[model samples]
Target: MIEAVSLTKRYGNTVAVDNLSFSVKPGKVTGFLGPNGAGKSTTMRMALGLDNPTSGQIRIDGKIYQDLKYPLRKVGALVDPRWVHPNRSARAHLAWMARSNRIQAKRIDEVLDAVGLTAVAGKRVGGFSLGMSQRLGIASALLGDPEILMFDEPVNGLDPEGILWIRNLMHRLADEGRTVFVSSHLLSEMALTASELVVIGRGKLISQSTTDEFVARASDDAVRVRSPHLQRLRGALTDAGATVHEVDDAIIVSGMDSANIGETAAAHNVVLHELSPQQGSLEQAFMQITGDSVQYHSDLDEAPGQVLASGTN
Candidate 1:
C-alpha cells in the first residue's frame, strides 16, 4: 500500500501541493483526478520522492522512497513518458533501467512483449510516436514487476485501441494484487477504469471515496415522470414534498424514487406514461463538484460549428 500523511510541497512563494493525505491500497485501481493546475503531478512527484515535501511525508509500504533497498522493485512509475533519452533504442532504454535497479536483463524482453513493443524494441525512441512512447514508458515501469505502480495520463495520446489496451493492462496489474494509482483528465474513462477515486483541486484534497459512493453523494435522487395528466401529477408530487421541474414535456421529480412516484400517482388516480429513476452520471457529478475549481473557462457562446464558420474567411 502507499500512504501520504499530510503531504505538502512548495516552490519558492507558490505552494504546489498543500497538506494532502490519502492512501492507495492493493488489488484496486485508484484514479487521481483534478482539473488543470490542480497539483496532481506535483503530488505524484512527492509520492515517488522526486521532489521533497516542504512539510509532512509520504511512505511506500512504511518506508520512504529514497530509503528503499531497491526502489524500482517496490514501486514503478510512468510520470513522464518523454523522460527517455531520444537517442536510445527502446531496448537500450529498458536495459539501462534494469541495470540501475540490478534487475535481470531477461525481464526486458518480458516487459517489452507485455506492453506490445516487442516488434519495435530495436527502434530509436526519438522516432516513436507519442502512443508508442507511452507503451515504452509502461514497459520500463514493468521492468521490475513492482508491487506498486503509478501512471500519469497513460492514455494521453493513445487511439481507441491503445486506450483499451492500457485500461485492460491496469486492471490486470491490480488483479495481481498491485497498488495501481493513475491520474487522468478523461472523466469518462476514469469512471469505467477506476474502482476508487482521489479527487483534489488547487493543491487540496476534495474527496476520497469509492467510485459509486462519490457519484451517489454528488448526485440527487431524481425520478423522471411523463404523463398526459401533467398538471395533476405535478400537484400530487409537489404536495408529497417532492420538488418538481419541467423539461421538454417531462416532469423531473426530486427527493423521491420511481416507486414512490408511481404509487403517489396511482393513489391520486393520475395515469402515468413513464416513470424512470435518473441517476447522475460520473461526468455530471464531476462537473457539479469541480465547477468552482476549474482553472480554465471557454467564452465561446455559440456551438463549435457556428464558431468555426464565423472564423472562416
Candidate 2:
C-alpha cells in the first residue's frame, strides 16, 4: 500500500499540496482526481521522491522511497511520457534504465511486447507518434515488473482503442494484486476504470472513498414524472412532501423514488405517461463537489455577438 500522512509541499510562498493524507491499497485501482493546478502532480512527485515535501511524509509499504534497495523494482511510474532522449531508440532507452537498475536485459523485450511496442522497439523516440511514445513510456515503467504503478495522464494522446487498452491493462495489473494509482482528467474513463477515488482541490483533500460512495454522496435521487394530468400529479406529489419542479413539460420530483411516486399517483387516480429515476452521473457529481474549488472560471455572460466579435479580433 501507498500511504501519505499530513503530506504538504511548498514552493516559496505557494503551497502546492496542503496537509493531504490518503492510502492507496493493492488489488484495486485508485484514481487521483482534481482540477488543473490542484496539487495532484506535486503529490505524485513527492510519492516518488522526485520532489521533497515541505513537511510530513509519504511511504510505500513501510518505508520511504529512498529507503528501498531497488526502487524501480518496487514502484514503476510514467509521469511524463515525453521525458525521454529524443534520438534514442525505444529499445535503447529501456535498456539503459534496466541496466542502471541492474534489471535483467531480457526483461526489456518482455515489457516492450507487453505494451505493444515490440514492432517499433528499434525506432527512435523522436520519430514515434504520441500514442507510440505513450506505449514506450509504459514499457519502461514495466521493465522491472514492479508491484506498484503510477501513471499521470496516461491517456492524454491515446486514440479510442489505445484508451481502452490502457484501461484494461490497469484492471489486469490490480487483479494480479498490484497497486495501480493513476491520475486523469477524463472523468468518464475514470468512472469505468477506477474502483476508488482520491479527490482534491486547491491543494487540500476534498474526498477519498469508493467511487460508488463518492458519487452517491453528491447525487440526488430524483424521479422524473410526466403525465397528461400534470397539475393533479404535481399537487399530489407536493402534498406527499416531495419537491416538484417542471422542466420541458415534465415534472421532476426530488426527495422521492420512482416507486413511491408511481404508487402515490396511482392512489390519487393520476394517470402517468412516464415515471423514471434520474441518477446523477460521475461528471455531475464531480462538478457539484468541486464547483467552488475550480481555479479558472470561464465567463458565461458574453452574448453570442460578443463571442463572435472576440473570435474575429
Candidate 3:
C-alpha cells in the first residue's frame, strides 16, 4: 500500500501540493483526478522521491521511498513517457533499465510480452507511434515486476482500441493482486475504470471516496420537462413543491423521478411534448466539486441555478 500523510510541496510562491493526504490500497485502482496545473504530477513526483516535499511525508509500505532497499522491485511508475532513448529498441530500453537495477536480463522479454510489445520489441523506438511508445513505457515500468504501479495520463495519446487495452490492462493488474494507482483527465473513462478516486483542486484535497459514493454525492437524476403550457406546469409543480427551471421556452421540473413527473403532469392537466431525465454527466459533477479552486475562470457567469418550480437563466 502507498500512504501519503499531510503531504505539501511548494516552489517559491506557488504551492503545488497542499497538505494532501490519501492512501492507495493493494489490489485496486485509485484514480488521481485534477485539472491542468492542479499539482497531480507534483504529488506523484513527491511520492516517488523524484522531488522532496516542503513538509509532511509519503511512504510505500510504511517506509520512505528513498530508504527502500529495492525500490524498483516495490514500486514502478510511468510519469513521463518521453524519458526514452529514440535509437533504442523496445527490448533494449527495458534491458538497460534491468541492467542498471541489477535485475536479471531475462525479465526484459517478459515485460515486453506482457505489454504486447513482443512483436515490436526489436523495432527502434523512434519508429514507434504514440500508442506504441506508451506501451514501451509501460513495459519499462514493469521491468522490475513491481507490485505497485503508478501511471500518469496513461491514455494521453491513443486510439479507442488502445485506450480499451490500457483500461483492461489496469484491471488485469489489480486482479492479479497488484496495486494500480493512475492519474487521468478523462472523466468518462475514469468513471468506468476506477474503483476509487482521489479528487484534488489547486493542490488541495477536494474528495477521497469510492466511485459509487462520489457519484451518489454529485449525480442528481432529475426529470426535465418541456411544454408550451409552461406557466400552468410551473404553478402546479410549485404548488406540489417540485423544483423547476425555465429553459429557452420550456419548464423543467426536477427534484422528482420520471414517474412522479409524469403523474404530476397528468394530475395538473399539464401537457408536455418532452420529458426526459437530466442525467448529470461526470464532467458536471467534477466541475461542481472543484468550482471554487478552479485556476482559470471565464468572464461569462453561467452558474446553473437551482430552485423550486421556476428558475431564470
Mark the regions of model 2 whose C-alpha exceeds 4 Å error after superposition.
226-228, 239-241, 245-250, 272-274, 302-313
Arranged by lDDT, best first = 2, 1, 3
Pull out the clashing pairs in model 3: 244-309
lDDT of 1: 0.90
TM-score, each model? Answer: 0.91, 0.92, 0.84
lDDT of 2: 0.91
Give per-residue CA lDDT, model 3, range 88-140, as digits (tens): 88888888788877889899888888778888888899889888888888887
For this target, which candidate reaches the highest TM-score against the unseen true structure? 2
Stronger candidate by TM-score (2 vs 3): 2
Q: Which tens-of-lDDT digit does each residue in 1-313 have in candidate 1?
A: 9899998888999777888999999999999998777889988888888899999998999998999988889999999999999999999999989999999999999999998999999989999999999999899889899999999999988999999999999999999999999999898999989999999887888999999989998888888889999999999889999999998989999998888998999998998898888878788888889888766555457555343331210
Model 3, position 77: C-alpha lDDT score: 91
Give per-residue lDDT, candidate 3, residue 36.
68
Q: Which runs of model 3 end up more than 4 angstroms from their true locations?
A: 224-235, 245-252, 257-278, 297-313
Per-residue lDDT of 138 in model 3? 86
CA lDDT of every candidate: 0.90, 0.91, 0.85
